[model samples]
Each structure stands twice: as C-alpha cells, then as structure tokens.
Target: MAGHPLKKIQCESIARTSGKQCRAKGYLKKSGHYRCRFHGGASTGAITLEGKLIAYKNLKQFKNYTDEQLLIWIQNKLQKSSSV
Candidate 1:
C-alpha cells in the first residue's frame, strides 16, 4: 500500500506519533479512516486542535470522543468482545 494515495494519512500519522516514518498500513477501525498499529486501538474519532470531528468511520476510530459517546461505545464494544 506504499503508493496508495488513500493510505497517506495513516503513514503520516504514524510518522508524526512514532518519530519514525513507516509504510505499514491497516484498515481504519470501520472503513475509510486509517491508522498504524501504534495509534489504532478502539479509536472513536480524530479532531482538530480546537476539537472538531475531522473523520470517523466508527466509534472505535477515535482516541478521544465525547464522554457520552465514549461511555456508550466502550460499554458496547466491551460487552461484544466479552461475549465473543
């Protein structure tokens, strides 16, 4: 996926957070968003510095979501994961 335009954000974010550029890629929790393993763990959404939803495919696509949203998604995912 190195030359894939759509995976650029994932690569950039990984580089920004890890301090080392990477080409690894994975599906964004839901569909459209993308993130490297280091930053991809049940994210709910990505926001701007002032706090605005920039992109979100699922509740697990963000690292910081509103309190209400976080509570609901966390509860749901936890329950589902446990059941599985």
Candidate 2:
C-alpha cells in the first residue's frame, strides 16, 4: 500500500501461448526463476547486459526493490499490491 502497483497485461495461463504476459500470477517454483517452467523458469543464473537503455529500464523497474526484496516479492505470489 506504500507504492504504486505495476500495470501490465495478465498472462493467460490457460492459453499457453501468451501466458508469459500475465499480470502477476507468477510462474511455477524454482530458486531464481520468475517465469513459468516453459520459459526458463527453473534456471539459476545472471547475465550482464551492456547498454544504457537496457540498464535504465532495469533500474526503473527494480529501483525500489533489492535482492532481498525480490525474494520476498516472488514468495508472495508476485504480488504487486504492496511495496516490495
């Protein structure tokens, strides 16, 4: 309730084709994955991108959350209704 919730399309879990676009239902389980099992959801890894545009985009979306916050966020069914 402390921050603004994100606005996006809710991925249709039933459709399968566009399921990844779902609002915040979130993917199946794994340590570091957020997408469904079909979309590399069980991978543990990180890659560094080299681009100011991409960097800014990431920063803007994740500016309020930390590594720890992300873990908690994911645990709570990817809920964006509250602050991360």
- What does candidate 2's lDDT look like per residue over 1-84, in tens digits? 334446432333443566445445345354443543444445443333223333444666767776666555444633563556
Q: lDDT for every model?
A: 0.56, 0.46
Weakest ten-residue segment in model 2 by summed lDDT: 45-54
| Candidate 2 TM-score, C-alpha based | 0.22
lDDT of 1 by residue, 1-84 (tens): 337677355433537666875666654666455666765666554434223332332446666677566556556865797999
Model 1, C-alpha of 43: deviation from truth (Å): 7.2
